[model samples]
Target chain A: MIENFKKRFQKDGIWVLFLLPALLIYLVFMAAPLLDSMRLSLYTGKGYTPTEFVGLQNYIDLFTNPVWRERFLGALKNTVIFFAIHMIVQNSLGLFFANLLSQDFKGRNFFRTIIFAPATLSVLVTGFLWTLILNPHWGAINQTLKAIGLDSWAKPWLGDENLALVTISLASVWQWVGMPTVLFLAGLLGISDEILEAARVDGASSWHIFWKIKFPLLKPVVGVVAILTFVDNFNAFDVIYAMAGAKGEPGYSTDLLATFFYRTGIAGEHPIGIPNMGMGAAIATITFVILMTGVLIWLYSSRKNEDLV
Target chain B: MSRTQKLFTYSALSIWAFVAIFPIWTLIVNSFKPQKEIFSNPFGLPQNFTLEGYKAVWLKGNFGTYFLNTIYVTVISLALIIFFGSLAAYALAKWNSKSSTALYVFFIAGLMIPIRLGTIDLVRLMQFLNLQDTIWSLIPVYVAMGMPISIFILTAFVKNLPREMFDAAKVDGASEWRIYLQIVVPLLRPAIATVAIFNMMKIWNDFWFPLVFIRAEESRTVALGVSLLFGQYRTDWTRALSTLSLAAIPILILYILLSREFIKGLTAGAVKG
Candidate 1:
């Protein structure tokens, strides 16, 4: 066994040289910190230092303690609502657009470029731009509504508590719908011309063909898109932070786990904000677990589906 | 398709396209308008195109410095990600051992787990390394964050290369390193471009790491700079819009020029994986 191992090492050892730099960097920066953060979550701390191991007390507080629980549950509900909006509004529009663009329309590339343009821009730019457009005073939406004789329709979209979360979700959907559209378009294109042609030869209408043939084939892509959206929405922060500030203002209506984690762990409370690194780490660990579990379940189920197929 | 269906498609596409471009249009138009004009006619074209907003942001806000800093960070990080990622991908693709499979899985796992969750300890780690608040601090983290997808994409590309070439090189007495440097590196150009473009977008537009890791003014990237400017100039609509336009316009122009490559790189990984 030793001789066999030595022979294998001698043959493949050069590969280690190639892998070492990235491995070292990823292990140190990405992997190590993840473990350390999980460890930190088990301890209690006042500032940046974790002094005592109160194993899982932080997690307990995250669920039971009123303040932390309120914020956590609120952020979790908002996050789910955020994901639901994407799954419904953003993805449906993406599919509709993908279906439209899939037709051999003139200037398809032009339209594709225009639609996907926002996805490439910085989230900060998108958030800032939308904040101006949605601003209650002298903002374009309100002014346009007034101009068109719907004077009472426009409100402070980002400033109203009830409307804030939905408004931010809509703005984010506006920026990112193109991603799923492009992905679905790719999936649409993957259907062979022969199959489409055969379906056309039949009396099946385009709608029937899409529903009966194309949509079924696109299930895998749909699953992938759903999982991607789930992970991304759960991890979302930049757009909300850019628009509503870190507090997820308008009464924390737009607070996400990401922003809440930022507030608790990194930034702490404003003006005499003592950093609750332990609690923050707890939040981060919870987020990590939820995300991993979601992805693993999707992976396992998708693999099972493939086997059954 | 029927005439009505065609018309519907056209109208829907047109409306959505308009919606997509409207915010950006507002930014550009309002950035040039005087403040009072923007307030009065939010949707109208600027009465007169003015460079004052741009000038103020460029000179007073020091966006020029932030722009250069962003470019520096983005380029350096992309270089490191592509170099190390391609090397590691090449090894994993060619070695074809049990350990290679394990390593591939390990790296790809980074994709599902958002690295930002580890921000708490990452900050502590950076402080321990004495690298906090420096521009150089971002490079390693970005490289590490970007490696998983880079390695994943490049490995697929490497595996597609003809095997006889490597076998022939081995027979010619060329060392593995020389072969990789001379033969494999050159052949991986398309994959490198794909990886570079993807990483460039992420590292260029990333705000989270730069926000947490760097607080010093000298190290602020464009995203952080623009966000900070927006906060400071909340009521200065013209200047705020101008700063956003400055941050956005270059990327929009690049996207237009390279939309095909950008879309291809983005969709390629999704379709395959």
Candidate 2:
């Protein structure tokens, strides 16, 4: 066995050498930090200095303490609402647009390029740009509304607590709708022409064809899109941070897990509270688990459905 | 395919397209106007097109430095990610060992994991390595962040290639390194382009890492620099708009020039995965 192992190692040593650079970097920088962060969650501390090894105390506080629990639950609720908004509004609109673009129309490429253009720009630019447009006084959105005799519809979209979360969600949807649209378009193109032709020969309308044929065939892509949206929305921070600041302000109405984790971990001091690194690490670990659970559920369920098919 | 349906499609598309472009159009148009004109005639054509806002951003805001720092980080990170990602992918694709499957699964699992969750320890590690507040700090992090997807894509690409090509090369007495560098690397162009475009967008627009990792002004990326600008000059719409345009326009131009490839690459990643 020792001689056999030696021979195998000699033969495959060069292949191992090829994998070394990427594996080393990934293990050290990505994988190691993930494990360390989870470990850090076990200890309670003021900052980076953990004073005590309180096992799962931080996680308990995350659920029990009034301030921590309130923020944690609020962030979780908001994160769900954020994901729901994307899944409902963004993905639906993306499908609609993709269906429209899939038609043989003039200027289809132009329209596709224009719609996807915003997704390419930095979130900082998009966030700030929308902030200006949604500005109450002289911004174009309000001004346009006033000019069109619908001044009552205009309000401080990003500032009012009741509307802030929805407004931010819509802004994110606007920027990222292109992602699903393109993915869905690719899926639509992948549907076999023969299947569509048979449906057409049977006198199926476009809407009927889409509902019965295209939508069902697009199930796998839809699963991919939903899971991607789930991960991205849960991990989202930049747009909210840029538009509403670190506090997810207008009273934490727009706080998601990512922003909440940032404020709790890094900001350390604020008017509302002080940062606890242990609590922050705990939040991070929770976010990680939630994301992993989501992806795994999607994977297993999709696989099971595939087996059924 | 009827006239009414075509018109309806065009109208619907036109409206949504307008919604998509309007904010960016407003930013670009307003950036050219003076502050007074922006407030007075917000949507009007710029009566006086000036470079003053761009001038302030370029000269006063030190955006030029931020731009260069971003380019430096992005280029170095892409080079390392492509080289190492393709190499690792080649091994996983061609090697038929039990460990290869384990290694492939290990790397592919990074796809679902958000690297931002590990930011706490990353800061500590950076401090330990004395890489804090330097461009070098972001290089390894970006490369690591990008690896799982790059390797996944490249491995699929490498697997689909004619196996006999590699065997022929091996029989010709070419070293493994030679086979990878000369034979595999050139054939992986399509996958490489896909990986490059995806990584470029992520790295170039990434705001979180730069916000957390780098503190010095000189080390700041353009995205971070633009955010800082937004914080400081929130009310100064003229300069703020210009700064945003400066940050966004280059990538916009790149996307327009390579829209077909970018779309193909992104959709390929989604469909294949």
Candidate 3:
């Protein structure tokens, strides 16, 4: 039996070697941390120093406790607002640009390149750039507004609780609209020109053709972009963290879920020095579940559509 | 094709083109103006066009070093992704059975799952491996993170490769390894280029990885270095604008020169779903 086992190991050794690196990396890094975070979420304490087996108490507090509950719901509302703004501004603008550029024009390539340029820059860079532009006191935007006799419109966009989230979301939209535009453009190109010509022959208006024909054909690609937007918007951290800092603050106005988790986990309670890894982990777990549900629903819908077809 | 509709389309395209190009133009023009002019008349051309900002940015910031570091990381990562990624993809594609399908799914699962979820443990693992605060730490992570998407694209391309080439190679007593290197690799050039461009832009522009992993200023990539510069001084518009223009110019020139291929690659990658 020993000899047979040794021979089997020797024969399979190369495959084992080939698989070792990826498996080791994934297991050590991906799987273990996720599991650990989930495990951490079950334990609770005053802070980082856990002393009790709370067993979903953190989650319970999240839902039941007013202080935590309000914060949670507020962040959720802001996130929804953020996402709604992006869908309207980013996706709609992307569709508009895609529609415009679908028809040939001089320097079309150059236009595409410039339009997509912001997407290539890091969001951190883009965020900082816009923050400077929108700075209330010394911003070029205000200066331009004043120069053009529109000075009344200028405000501390990032410093106002009311405008901070909206302003930041618009900046995010500007940086990312290129992505969906290109995706939509690709979808447009995939559509047969002959069908569009047929619509033309039928005396359909351009807007009518776009709404009735191309829009329906582009549903799958649109679905993909939507899910992508969903995942990315939820995972968003760097831009907000860089621009608004961890609290999403102008008095916690922009406090996103990711930032909230970060503050609780690592930065600690400002008044308190202790970190609450367990609670943070619980929040992270909830966030992950929400994201996973979104993804799974998307996959199921796509698969069901395929089955029907 | 109605005249009025055509006119509207052209007008819309023109307006968008203006909007897109305007910010870039503003950055460039702003970089050439002195700080006072920039603040006083934000919209006009520079009163006295100067290279002083560029001179200052290059001399003081050591942007050259940042540029070199970015290029090194991006190029090396690209080579690895194209090579190992393609090799693994070819195996997954050619095996064409239940086990390979499982492996394919295993690799592609990394797509839906964000790598940041594993970030805590990854940092610890990097520390344990003693790769913290180093460029080497980024390479493997980037490669591993990038593999699934690269494989997905390359596999699609591989599936479309002409079968006769493989058949001919097989008839000449070529092994699978030989067929992959000799026959398959060359035909994959366009797809590989497409993949390379997409990955290059991601690496060159990434800030999160650098912010988390690279602690030393000496180790900073262009994106991180420039951001650090911005952070140090809150209201230095002249220098900040200089830095922004510096970061953008190289990529701008690249995009302008290869606009067609670059846009093609982007649209192709995105719409593939």
Candidate 4:
């Protein structure tokens, strides 16, 4: 029995050492805190430490309480819009660029490099850069419009409540379009050349080929791209914080779930100027649930069909 | 193939290319001009060049220290993630067991979820460990955050590796560690490069974690520092542009130098192959 146990230990020991470091760090640093934050959401705290367990009270306030409810719903709505624009504009442009690049082309590498350049820069930098370019009175866009004698076209880009979210979302789309471009390009390249050639031999145009054949094959990648956009925009913060400020300024037209959480939980929310840790955790939990639901759906759907990705 | 198709592709691509390059061009060229000139000539090349913005950024801020801090965190976190991540991935690829399969699924789940959700408890965790407000705090968090994707990519790469290589090494009486180092490590260089570049972009350019975890001048990262300076220098366009250019230029230069590898690396996570 002792010898058998030793043999089993010998077989296990090396793998255990290999796995433990990453696993322990992942659990203690990332996974545990994520789970604990959910638990902490149930209890209100005047400080860092929660004094009382108010089970589900924080969530209730988040849903029903006037102030929290408005911010939560506003952020949720804006995130959806932000994600929609990314899906429609960024991914579409990405597919467009990918289609163009996948064809026999000159300077394809150069264009691909230029297209993806913005994504490498910090979102804070891009956010601030766009804030400068989109400045109302003296920005590049306005100045160009004025110079071109289309002065009427230039308006408050970031200042308007109606247009601010779209403007920021476009800026974000501009920055990250390269990602989906690269992804789609890979998917496009993966299409067996013979199949596309056969379609062309049958007199199919590029448009029909792209929509009818290429797109259906690219579904798995699209799902990946969609879930990526969802996770990113749902928690989108740095862009808004940098462009619009942490309060999601211009009357909070640009507040995202992440920035909203920052204001409420980490920094004190405005006016009352006190950190509500529990409420912030509640927001985080909600965001987590939304993300998990989106992910599970994608997973279930993808599992049903053999993915090209 | 047709004239019209080629023309449409070139023109459309050229136009989109311009849209892509224009803002960044404005950013870089504007930084070199003086304050008044920035507003006057936002579109033109710097007619009269000035290093005033760069000088002010250097003198007025801990920009140098923040730059170094970012590098330190990125390198340390990357080293940990690669070392530990590769080890686990190697075992997962080689070991045929139900537990390994289960563990692999567990790590891969992190790819879909954002790590920011844990900031509430993470803040407390940092404070509890006396790591809050220190650059030391960022490393562990980043390594942990990097794990899932690193494991996801590396394990796939490793699993695709030839079985004969591992068997041959073992047949020659090599230990698992020996096989990993001598055989696996060399073969994994490309995948390692992919994982490194991916995580480097995240760690180097991240603003959120630095904002939450580190506040001291000594501890601030390039992203956090730039954001702070942007807030302070809102009205001073020249300085703001220069500060941004400073933070952005290194990675931009890196991207330019290694565009092919960089593009491939960034897409590694999404593209299964």
Candidate 5:
């Protein structure tokens, strides 16, 4: 057995040379920091370095401390709303667009390219552009509304407290709808031509076939798209930072958990203007937990779905 | 399909097409107009065109430096990711061992758990290494962030390769490196393209790392530059729009030229998973 092991090692030892660079880099930069950040969360201090170890205190403060609690809860609420908008609006629009593109049609490639062009641009650029376009006075949307004699419909998109989060979410949806569209389109196109032909031969209407057949077939892609959307939205930062400022301005209505983490951990909350590294790490740890929960749930449900199939 | 169904499809698509294009059109077109003209005629096709915005951004701002900095970082990071990623993936594919399998799972886990959560610690690491304010800071983080997806895609591709080729090369006394160069790489071109395009988009468009690590104008990326420009030129609509347009036009042109590959590359994960 020892000889056999030695032989295997002698033969495949080149694998070590192949694996070391990536493994070393991954361990040092990614895996180490991720775990160490959790360790750092137990400590609290000012500026970039947290020297004091106060176990569970930062987490407690995040939950119960008045100043921290309001911002924490507000960011949490807005993040969920941001996530919900993507799940409903973004994914629905993606599915609709994908279904439309699935059928044979004219200018199909042109429409596909047009729909996806925005996704190539930076989120920062899109956020800033939309903020300009959605401006209350001379921006395109409001001006066009006024031009069409719907003057009363013109309102501040990024300026109002209640509207800011939703507006930003929609702008993000606009940028990324291509992801799900392409994913869903791939799935739709994978449906066998024979099955679609059979449906047509059975005298089923196009609407009936799309709903009863194509939509059901798209369940797996839907799962993947929703999970991707959930993960992306929770981690979203650039949009709010660009459009509403890093503070998630307008009374912090647009504040998502990521921007909250940025404010608390990296940039430091204003006035005192010192980063609370421990609290930041704690926020990250919580975001980590949330992401893991979501992914595990998705995995379990998808596996169960496969078993049923 | 019926005539009404065709009309419905075309019109519905047209409305969304309009929604998608209008903002981008205004962004590009209005960048050419004078400052006040932008606000005065927000949606029009620049009746009085000028290169003033572009000139200001290019000549005065550090826009050119930022563009070059972004290109340098993106190219170097992508090269490292592909090099390290492909090597690791090839071994994991060929080395039938419990440890190899475990390592594959370890890397793949990163796909779900974002590398952003590790930012605070990474910042500390960067400072410790004296890289906090330089372009070098972003390289390791992006390469590390990119590893999981690259390995995930490339490993799956490698696994399906004909096993007999490796055995044949082995019998012929070809060293593993030679075999990898002469054999695996030739076939891995398309998959490499897939991996390259996938990570290219993320690294090029990324704002978070540059935001966290770099502060100096010489080291700032395009995304960072745009954010700073927005703040500086907030009241100057033409310059602001021009900055955005300058940063965006290259990507738009690239997407149009390589739409098929871009679409395939961006959505490669869906197919792979």
Candidate 6:
């Protein structure tokens, strides 16, 4: 067997042997499932019943029907809101912390570790922790607010319709801020020390160094981070499900597309015993399209820039 | 740095640190308090702090079983990722061919498409294979899901390595397998570690897979188990808090301990991509 493999390798057969197994598994499990879901979306039927070719009816109903349209648009609006807040808060704070931590200061590592800790845990754990901390009846957030003479500011953050989604986004931003911060920091580190020294010798302040010199150079990394945040936020389910739940509770205030799909397509109390697999697949397809479009646009621009470079 | 700015910087960092960690701190402190007292004064120490919450959650909540199950799934999935991912990555990195680009794209496709999209069929497939309610079911799913990114990163890292190393090995009449196993594998330690740590955190934190696939008591990961505990006692914040603490302690400690490697992996992965 070993001699035979030596012959095959001499004949340039190693790539075939190496790539086959992984590709086979990915094709079967990943590509097949994705394609199968799209195929499933083309058919509509009740649970355990025979199905017929519905063609584009499902897509039409999704966009045209009032109830589905309202909920779908609502989820879209809420998701956009979630992504917007994260882009502003998460990225800005990430840049701020990255800048601050990059400075020569005592206990910087300690602060970095502490700040990055939430990013390590599952969104589930962080969501649960914040839920506990913001429990209106017994949460420390309310306690602190009361202590600071802002007692009226406290509410059941996860339960209030007005605050639930924003609160959940903030929780997500907290868990994921470390990622963009680290990305920005890497970009910061890549800037030459001599360049910074040159800037410093020219009498530029630290703020000027960052805004004028460092920020523009960090644009590529920031672009990558922004697109990542956008895609992840669009598909974000774990934090919302963990905090607000599958129905996107508190009057469906926190209902993003992912959770809405889970409820409508995957896990809700379908009147029938079987799930609405097609409707769920439709939701998943929409999410996939939106996310892939965002990613492809980013990649296209980045590739063009790389070519110019 | 000026003296005033130095002091101001340290002070700002400290305040942010305190704010960043306050939620978990609150969870620990509140876990000891009785349910009645939690609502009254959540900020202060309990008048009669006790071990009742922890004791109840540990014994009644069955966190031990959940922890063991989580460990089994995470460790096995990570092992599969390292072994299978590196082999594929070796071929993709070393063998520059038209097919390798396609193979790379094939794997890259898996990254953009989230695995949950196929839930309708995946659940059916799992049931057909009799893997529902089993921890083993998550292994292939995770391996397949994680393969693309791992291979992508590993290929990039390996491509960056000096070409002379592989040449040196081959000049010694080393077999292809020998070149990969002996030379390439050793050199890939940091990349493998980065991939392992990244995948480990993700696998441990995953909740949707367990909720969708595992229905039995022995199959539940910590995240799923904690969610179940929350469901059981929706109004019982103290018990839920205790369960949360049990779930969070190990991960939080691991984060603090190896944050440098974790951050390095994260930044490299993000920036390069």
lDDT of each: 0.90, 0.91, 0.77, 0.90, 0.92, 0.82
lDDT of each residue in B1-273, candidate 5, tens digit only: 679989988999999999998999999999999988887887789989999999988887788899899999999999999999999999999988898999999999999888999999999999999999899999999999999999999999999999999999999999988988899989899889999999999999999999999999799999999998888888889999999999899999999999989898877866658
Predictions: Cα RMSD each = 1.3, 1.2, 3.2, 1.4, 1.3, 2.7
Per-residue lDDT of A278 in model 4:
88
Q: DockQ of each candidate's interface versus the true one?
A: 0.86, 0.87, 0.40, 0.87, 0.83, 0.70
Per-residue CA lDDT of model 4 for A218-239, tens digit only, reads 9989988888888888889999
Higher TM-score: candidate 2 or 6? 2
Look at candidate 3 and give me any clashing residue pairs. A48-A275, A248-A254, A248-A255
Ranking by DockQ: 4, 2, 1, 5, 6, 3
Candidates 2 and 6 compared by DockQ, better number: 2
- On DockQ, the stronger of 1 and 6 is 1
DockQ preference between candidates 1 and 2, better one: 2
**CA lDDT of B204 in candidate 1?**
90
Alpha-carbon TM-score of each model against the true structure: 0.98, 0.98, 0.90, 0.98, 0.98, 0.95
Model 1: CAPRI class: high
Second chain TM-score for model 5: 0.97
User: By lDDT, who's the top model here?
Assistant: 5
The deviation in Å at residue B158 for candidate 3 is: 0.9
lDDT of 1 by residue, A1-309 (tens): 999999977888899999999999999999999888999999987887987999999999989999789999999899889989999999999998998998887889999998899999999889988888888977889888988999889899999999999999999999999999999999998889899889989878988998999999998999889888988999999999988999999899999999999999999888868788988999999999999899999999889989988
Question: Which residue runs does candidate 2 get wrong by more than 4 Å?
Answer: A271-275
True contacts kept of each: 0.89, 0.86, 0.31, 0.86, 0.81, 0.70
Two-way TM-score contest, 1 vs 6, winner = 1
Off by more than 4 A, model 3: A1-36, A43-58, A64-70, A266-280, B50-62
**Per-residue CA lDDT of candidate 5, range A176-213, in tens?**
98889999999999999899999999998888999999
Better of 2 and 3 by DockQ: 2
TM-score of 6: 0.95
Report the C-alpha lDDT of model 1 over B1-273, residue by residue, as the tens digit. 779889999999999999999888888888999888888776678887788888988887778778888899899989899889989998999988889999999999998888898899998888999999888889999999999999999999999999999999999999989988999999999888888888899989999999999989888889988988888888988898989999999999999999999988888777788
Q: How well is candidate 1 docked (DockQ)?
A: 0.86
DockQ of 5: 0.83
